[model samples]
Target: MRLAALPRRPSEPTITLINVVFLMLIFFLVAGQVAAPVDRDIQLIDAAALATRAPDDALAVRSDGTTLWRGEVTTPEAFAAARIADGAEVLRLVPARDLPAQDLLRIANALRMAGAAEVRLVTDRSAP
Candidate 1:
């Protein structure tokens, strides 16, 4: 009589996938730039955070709803106009810790009027 066939080991397809994922993660960590606050002079608001970090080209606003571009005070309309003229589709705004909610919304609306597809708010990531 012939002997019964031996049992085979289970395949580990997930292991290869896991390895590739880890390699990609490590590659991104090494290649990506670390983020710093948009401006040292403009104290950013602190709140629940998001995954995406704003780029260095963000527009900063002070507590009084005064917008600053390239370290110069500017009206929201002016800032939006210049940025839109430069072919920017997405606008990143860093509002001060004491900036009023109404001001923020107004500035965002102005940016939208200037053809910004998206206006992302950037906040400070402070430990509680």
Candidate 2:
């Protein structure tokens, strides 16, 4: 009588690997929906006394007097218009410390023209 061939073993189940891949896919998919806030190219001017309250909208003014909108350089008119059109009632001006007073004034003017309900300047509080 011929010897019977040995039976081949079945491969291990791949449920664990499949589960891991499925989970990773889900993670990226969910994460993709949330975008990181854009940072304007304008350098931030940190103050010794910045307000604890957060501003509704941020406008960055670079040292060179360049303006940034959402981390990109933009004209004051354009930025202001966008916020006002979007119904942004409150606007915050975050200018670099080195930013000239004149530049700051320009921004304020633009905000007013855009019809902001309230415009607040973001400055660090002086040391007590």
Candidate 3:
């Protein structure tokens, strides 16, 4: 074994660095797609009593258990029929602030029995 000694091959750390850089690039691309970017310098508006837009298509239940659709007197069965006829499976209900819980449940059950697939209640964002 009198042959000349072979020089040691240099460790390839550059390949590992390149791999890490590519991985980070892919991760950032996915992360950036997940959320929209907001301007850091802009201050968002703050309001204590912002008025919420009431849903126009939602059924309104009064404190006395009366049902109204767009200000016209309506019943749960009629409302459900009208909504279903219009190809709407989901129903939105806006109950009065003083409406009883039992009345709400009874109305919801009636709507479900009349063929509503889902019923959702709309309320204000403010805490009482």
Best by lDDT: 3
lDDT of 1 by residue, 49-104 (tens): 54544355788988988788888888777877788888888888999888889988
Which ranges in model 1 have alpha carbons more than 4 Å from their true place?
1-56
TM-score (all chains, Cα) for each model? 0.54, 0.51, 0.59
Best by TM-score: 3
- Model 3 regions more than 4 Å off: 1-53
Alpha carbon lDDT of each predicted model: 0.82, 0.78, 0.90
Write model 3 residue lDDT over 36-127, tens digit each, in one string.
Answer: 77989997877755655447688999899999988799998999999999999999999999999999999999999999999999987665
Clashes of 2: 6
Lowest summed lDDT over 10 consecutive residues: which window, candidate 3? 47-56
Better of 1 and 3 by TM-score: 3
Residues 32-84 of candidate 2 have per-residue lDDT tens digits of 88878568776777874565433436777777888777768888778788888
lDDT of 2 at 97: 77
